[model samples]
Target: MRMVPMAEADLDAVLAVQAACYPPAMQEAADVVRARLRASPDTVLVARDADGICAYLFAYPSRLGKVTPLGSRFTLPDRPDTLYLHDLAVAPRSAGQGVARRLTDAILARAGGLRHSALVSVQDSRRFWESLGYAAAAGDGVALATYPAGALYMARRLSA
Candidate 1:
């Protein structure tokens, strides 16, 4: 699969992939996802193979210890030090095809001078993020509470 910047046209497919990956309680509405895309278009991406978009990754610049509560709009910081990976979903059919890794790598490659990268690991995907060098980290308690049970806030320092 090839990685490309997420476009408005990809929203439908992105939503489909998201629905297929996450439970109803964990899913964010389309409007929330669209607003995030507009807020930081450069950090959102979609993976496409011959069939079509099979995965997506949404990220934004923010403080390392902060957590974006589910369904809330992203409030970008004036002096961001971390790239927060907000969401990542791969179509069930595309699982194990390296699509998620490809999208993650692409976003990290675009992180520029950020000092770290973080994400909220849900749906029991902690091992996947851990394999990518992330480790459980503290986050805003109130914000973290918005997630389902067992969700973890994870982060990793970036190499200069």
Candidate 2:
């Protein structure tokens, strides 16, 4: 699969992959996803192959120590110091194929000037983010409360 910017044409497939990867309660609506795409088009990406979109990563410019509550629309910080990796989902068919890693690396590559990167690890995926150099960070307890049980806010410093 190849990494590419997410386009409006890809929303259907993106939603499908998201549905396959997350439980109903965890999934964001199309409008919310569309708003995010509008807010930070450059940071959102999709992984596609001959079959179609196999994975996607939704990210946006944000401040360190900030948490985007589940289902909330993205808001670009006035002075972003970090890239917030809001969501990453790979189709069930593409699991164990390293698609998630490649997609994440692609996003991190675009974050060259940022001072840090952060994410909310859900569904017991903290170890996966840990392998990518993210560590659990102190987060707003109220903001974190929006997520399902066991969600963690993690961060890692990025070299400029």
Candidate 3:
């Protein structure tokens, strides 16, 4: 399999893989995704085998949004050096083969050598991130602001 940076031409295939992997409510709008690629294509990572694109992750170095202040429930720390993992999806056919993990490692490695930590909005895979050393921020509920959909906030420090 090959892990590569996203390109404009990859959008249709990436969108297909994402739709195949997520529910409608969670699937990103194709236009929004295309815009993100136009602005920051390198932020998205994809996995492809001989057949085609199988799994992918959409991430960007993001800031703590208008959530509660630090130390509040679900409040993320106010730090700019954080990588925000927006989405991680593996094709149903490719699930359970460590595709997500591999994609994550590739993205993190590309984040350069200057970052405080990486964060992700987690929904069904709390255990998965915890296994990777992520945990609920000190703050819990009120601090998290649901985007288009509600998801829990978790973070992991990139070990230097």
Candidate 4:
């Protein structure tokens, strides 16, 4: 599978993979996902093969320490210091295939000028993010409260 910028035609498959990867409570409604795509098309990436989309990463440029709430739209800032990774999901078919790492490398390659990166590590996935060099950081508790209790706000410094 290869990672590429997501297109409108890929939304359905992306949403399907999202549903299969995340629990119902963490799932974003179709409308909300649409809004996110519309708001920051350049930041969304999709990986696919003959079977169709199997992995995706939704992210956008934003201020450091800030996060987009679950199922909410994002507005790219005029000057962004961080690349906020909103979601990264891989379908069962793509599991254990290094799909997530490839997509993440694609995002990082495109974010070379950013000062930092941030994400919400949910469902006890902090160890996974930690492996990528992200560490827990103080964030908006109220904003993060919308996610499950295990969610952690994590950040990593980027070479400028």
Candidate 5:
């Protein structure tokens, strides 16, 4: 699958692949996507194939640095510089491929001109994120994960 900038035409297919990859509580609904797209269009990316969307990456600028989101409260800051990756999902049917990496490359490409780091709360796939050069969140008590199967708060500083 090839990575692409998400557009209005790709919303339904993107959401479908997202739903297939993650649960409702963790995935953004159409309304949320609309809101986020309007406010933060630079933070979304999608990978597609002949069938449809295969993977996606969602991000937002965060000035709060690496404040880990626990439960429902996310530590968002106004006009932040750091790129916070909210989620990365590849459809179950597309797991073995390099879709996630290409999607991530798209996010990194977007974040390249920024001044802050790249952050992600990794879920059920610690090794995957590690392979991409993301490490556990800095400092003590940073290992907490809210995901049902648990996850790690990981980040990598983007050279500015």
Candidate 6:
């Protein structure tokens, strides 16, 4: 029903939504999730209704070409020029309700002067992201090897 900055108390609900939204292989451990929030509390957000948390977005500031390996802790960069959209998940019950779009819009609005927004698309989500202005980057497997075979590194230039 509403979006709010993620809080430590919201982790349990956030993890539950994440588990329901992603496959086992794609889920991050609770510690890693906590680390990411600690690293970028400003960018992480949660959408909750009277029932509980239904969606969440975990993003952070980072360099243009840097990649956060799947299932790893958030690695804060010294000077980040890009807003890395590390994870976005909506519970099955919340699907088709535009929760992702709202969260993404809020995050981008918060990006301020960041030059770009980037993310890795997994589970054949390229089309969904592409519709939001993201484009797949042509890169060697070596750079994206940490992801599942079909994953892609995608980016979108922001309008300053």
Candidate No. with top lDDT: 2
CA lDDT of 6 in candidate 3? 80
Which model is ahead, 4 or 5, in terms of TM-score?
4
For model 6 the TM-score comes to 0.95
Q: Which prediction has more favorable TM-score, 2 or 3?
A: 2
Off by over 4 Å in 2: none
Per-residue lDDT tens digits for candidate 5, residues 1-160, read 6787778777788778867877666665677665555556777788888788887776777752455443332445766767777767888888888888888777877774566555545456878877888777652244244454455567777777
Better of 2 and 4 by TM-score: 2
Stretches of model 5 off by over 4 angstroms after superposition? 64-79, 138-149
lDDT by residue for model 3 (39-89), tens? 446668889987788888776655433332222222233455666676678
CA lDDT scores, all candidates in order: 0.93, 0.94, 0.67, 0.88, 0.68, 0.89
Among all windows of 10 consecutive residues in model 5, the one with the lowest summed lDDT is: 64-73
Instruction: Tell me the lDDT of candidate 5.
Output: 0.68
Candidates' TM-scores? 0.98, 0.98, 0.79, 0.96, 0.78, 0.95
Candidates, ranked, lDDT: 2, 1, 6, 4, 5, 3
Q: Candidate 6 — worst ten consecutive residues by lDDT sum? A: 137-146
- After the best TM-score superposition of candidate 4, give how far the Cα of residue 86 lies from its true spot, in angstroms: 0.2
Higher-lDDT candidate of 1 and 2: 2
Return the TM-score for candidate 3, rounded to 2 decimals. Answer: 0.79
Worst 10 residues of 3 by lDDT: 67-76
Query: Which wins on lDDT, candidate 5 or candidate 6?
Result: 6
